[model samples]
Target: MRSVSRRSLLRGGALGVAAVTVAGCAEQEPRQAQRLAAEPPDPETMLIRQLIAGKERTVALYSSADSDRLTPFRQRHEAHLAELRRRLPRESGSASPASSAGAQADPSASPSGAATAGSQISVRDLRDMERKAAALRPRQLDGVSPALAQLIASIGACEAAHALALSRSL
Candidate 1:
């Protein structure tokens, strides 16, 4: 067999290297795409997160009040919070209350931060919050799973009752 020429051997080696480089780049493109593309959270997950935040807020509101009469209501909200937490997906479960509720100040706090630690949120304010939350549940049910829908409906009913009871108690 004729001896291989140096120029031909070099050209062959360069072509092989080029082929490997292209193949390696092609394999990496899909991986890079996967790393960059994040899927959005599901609607039910979002609803559950919001419900957890709202329940936390309601619990905090209840805690701020000195009335012993509101203890049972607060306990119910705590239960709701537990259930909502149970339903949260594993990946998102680590999200903190502040992150979920955003960076805003507490709902009962005054803009000037003048509301002292002993200041109590009014019954009317709680009632209005309950009414608004109750009204929002129906809208929230549209895209959630059946189990979640049922839970939301039950919570909404309780909130409506709370509003009515607060009105009578006032």
Candidate 2:
């Protein structure tokens, strides 16, 4: 029998294991964009849409805003909007259902859906929105795949961090 060096055998075994591990982790992502399209937006989904629209307006508002401190937070809100859209179906991603809901909630006033938790949303609104997102962090891990859950948690944390930074700037 031919003698194999112990170091050579170990190196070969390690390479084979590494290849198998990499291959195992390479599952194709499902076309969830299409899947979410066929379903009606749930209440949770509707809430997200509201937030997206609010962020969209925030980005637009802040871009023209005079406050130097708000510029980056506005940009972050824009990025956050894009990330939030990635989590939803392409079609409903553009919906502004919160405006309608807000209108319904108060007949005399316009649906200022962008209004944050505070009396009047200025830069402070970003902080409020981030606080709300942080509350959703734990739910990210519930019933979802670990990878997706982590993505959600990270995004939520990112929003929370943005809010913190914005608060300081204001």
The best candidate by lDDT is: 1
TM-score of each: 0.66, 0.45
- Model 2, runs deviating above 4 Å: 1-54, 57-66, 90-120, 145-147
Report lDDT (Cα) of residue 44, candidate 1: 74
For model 1, residues 91-167, the per-residue Cα lDDT tens digits are 75435666567423323222123333356787777777778777777887887889999998998898899889988
Which window of 10 residues has the lowest lDDT sum in candidate 1?
A: 106-115
Give the total clashing residue pairs for model 2.
0
lDDT of each residue in 27-139, candidate 2, tens digit only: 32244545665676765455455555555555655554457766776676677667766665555535444432331121111123466333345665555655665665666
C-alpha local distance difference test of each model = 0.75, 0.57
lDDT comparing candidate 1 with the true structure:
0.75
Q: RMSD in angstroms, all models?
A: 8.7, 15.1
